[model samples]
Target chain A: MKNSIAALYLIVVAFNFSCGQDTANQVATISDTPFTPELLVEDVAIPWGIAFLPDGSMLITEKSGELILFKDGQKNTLSNVPEVYSRGQGGLLDVAVHPDYENNGWIYLSYASEEGEEKGGHTAFTRAKISDNSLTNSQLLYKGSPNTTKGQHFGSRIEFDDKGYVYLSIGERGARDDNPQDITRDGGKIYRFYDDGRIPEDNPFVGTEGAKTAIYSYGHRNPQGLIKNPKTGDIWDNEHGPKGGDEINIIKPGANYGWPVITYGVNYSGTPITDKTAMDGMEQPIHYWLPSIAPSGMAFITTDNYGADWNGSLLVGSLKFQYLELLKLNGTKVTDRIELIKGLGRVRDVVQGPDGLIYVGVEGKGVYKLVPKK
Target chain B: MKIFLTSYILAVIGLSLYFFQDPALEASMQRGNEIYADFCVTCHLEAGEGVVSTFPPLAKSDYLLQNRAASIRGVKFGQQAEIVVNGVTYNSAMPSPGLEDDEIADVMNYILNSWGNTSDKIVTVEEVEAIQK
Candidate 1:
């Protein structure tokens, strides 16, 4: 009748494309390479932060907007690297270079753009410069506000502190009772700048009011990890909780840290997030990770090349424990805990190079280099 | 010899235009791979390797080929905590998805084109009904 019902719908779409099955997100190694580790690049898509290039080369990114560049081992691609607005947590996110990057070639980055007509995208922070290798000028610095399209949260990440100042991590995006009363909303804060973008009068909301005052800390919710604890210059973050909680804290400044109002996580339909966990004005989590290790990107390892028994430890990567967890504090209390690279699949971000080794990044096995196995 | 017969007739017209191509989104990537194998294969698994720290690896996932509407509103509502994909930072918890709007555009075009991903970009249910909600 209609040509045999369009040929019986092309034979049930070629029989569901001959049973298309493929599911292999990798990261559970332990055949123990004693530290051979060197795949370099595979089908990389969800890569996340790398940043080296004082000549040692490396720039990575990829939460889907691309931006590669590995050097010597080769892998280019870095023309514009913008178009982000990728939604649900946003895109392009985190890059950081300019710590006077060999005489200011600049770089910065922290995406999720495209706001307007009912907002829909947020979390910004630009800067740009590069030249022969791509990007140029760009600018922007910081944006984020009420911008809601319901793409989850944004909380971009970019760190630096050794007096050079510059830390950014803003997310509360899914609202979660708006972190603790908006405070002009930069989406549950942690900001501070001056790498040319300015705004560092000791930010704690500098002048306050409708507060855009490049905040410094506020009841955070999404924080994705930030380093700088060369002993105690302090600044250690490790967020993402809800359903078992998942914090790590240490950040300070104008503090708050609570979310959905003091939680240890409950409410993925389990509902509760707050009934205990010792509220007050909030702020408590020097260590947490009950049924959720979802952490993401953190370092601290402090050299000694994994020897002085992992000198002053810290490690932390665990995209749900695909492995890396080390901890071991003593001063800020974490007190020993090791897991080292167990499965390997979702450990998306942990850096410490310049040859002191230790560089993991996997969201589908692609970048690894944790040397020292004598 | 005349550039080897014009490079063997342009490699037989590029292998007969890639063997009579017309993937036209292969039946919406086999209905987004059976709605990502019955609802995102139990914690981005069945090969998305999302269960290390605790679920989050969509093969070539730069947060789903670069945040298309927050990864289509995390497949229409489901995504929590501070995520950071590609530069490392993921807070976990992404459940939302009962499926509709053409099965979230046939499972996000079968995850923007399976594992290795190339991205010609084809996610429509009128772009998920213009970002529902």
Candidate 2:
């Protein structure tokens, strides 16, 4: 009897030892620099898109449809904003200042609003001039088409090229079948247009029959971040892919990103969404994250104010793990990745401030700046 | 020594039986907490208070208390269009948690009891299975 009890104890102990799991929330980095986070502003509601003006004041869009200009330690709530469908994952989203804002003063706003008389909402892009914290000459730039009754995916990120063109990314709006693959309607396609809203004639599908003239690329799931690569003059987009397949891809004209067809991710219910990981004509991700980071806003680090080693790295915000991901790139490929600054709440956006410091926007908390350790 | 060994063996078996014998409702409720943590906690929050005006409150929700059948159906399947919970209407889609019948019952019990809610009866698996649409 004593021997039986001893044997049972040994079996339990061995089982426990074998079942131990790795629970580190952060991935190891190549060479991580120890830094500190400084709270810049507080008491803001769901700060979504953040852009700095030439004068250094920041334009931030709250998800609850309020636009505020934060400058000099004060938040000026602007009015004359359009009504937004401020429901689950739908509201006032990304904001951008025009490339020639100093001379033209054109400010852009992306929001989820009612699709005319349609049952659901569509992401609408509008541009205006900011005068004394008020919006003027606010003209509707473009609206994503074929709205349906869903609120989950509204990929509304805007990036401007140095060559007087703009790039806009829209999500599939849960319409996976006819949206991402079908080029006739605008759902999961990236649009390239003149800054004033004219569809570029050189856009990938401009002259193609039954294809949306504004479409630059197709087959994107929910591209949340769009930025122009400073070195190569290319567009880089980072998007959330179902459960695990978050991907960062270099955008090409008329490229098929392979959303539902080929994915490294599965459905949220843990079932395989696709069996094929790669196929013909579908561009693969330059970098993919398994066990999704729920990627949101992203920015390229141009300055090395933190250090020269940190210069030219890409900073991505994670809504799932609530951390910042620093991707060290070898040219266009991500060679190394590291998770930084955990336990800060859901990171919504990571942008470079006018002062060359990295500023992050959190969902519940206010903006935080990464400053050199004193 | 023989008598002592007999009593020890009996005691160990009795303890094992007792440890495995939890009331059905309590076991289900406990399992439901883990399921809730995995699925519902992100948008609804941990305390079930949910995001204001965006996600409808689940804590002592009058809508859940008044329309138990509809609530079960809403959770078991999916809820779309619009729903008025405590005078506030939510127009967003609440995706089905995509759980088994037993899991649905357990999560229902866990939610209906937590956060100031009161219930005299446990939500049975059969009750959840019987809920249509």
TM-score of each: 0.30, 0.73
Q: Pick the candidate with the highest TM-score.
A: 2
Candidate 2 positional error at A27, Å: 1.8
DockQ by candidate, in order: 0.01, 0.05
- What tens digits encode model 1's per-residue C-alpha lDDT throughout A308-367? 766887877877557777776777877556667676577878888777787888876568
lDDT at residue B101 of model 2 (Cα atoms): 81
RMSD of 1: 23.6
What is candidate 1's fraction of native contacts? 0.00
- Candidate 2: residue A337 lDDT (0-100): 72
- lDDT of candidate 1 at residue B61, scale 0 to 100: 69
Top candidate (lDDT): 2
Question: Candidate 2 on A1-374: residue-level lDDT in tens?
Answer: 99999999999968954542223222664345556788887866577899999998898888878898998989889989888865446788999999789899998888888858776678888899988778999999899876654656788899998899988888888788879999998878788889999988788887789988888998999899998888888999999888768889899999999988998787765678888889999999887786678899989888868777778989999877678988877887676678788767678888987788888997666788898764
Task: Give the alpha-carbon lDDT of every model.
Answer: 0.73, 0.81
Summed backbone clashes in each candidate are 33, 0
**Model 2 TM-score relative to the real fold:** 0.73
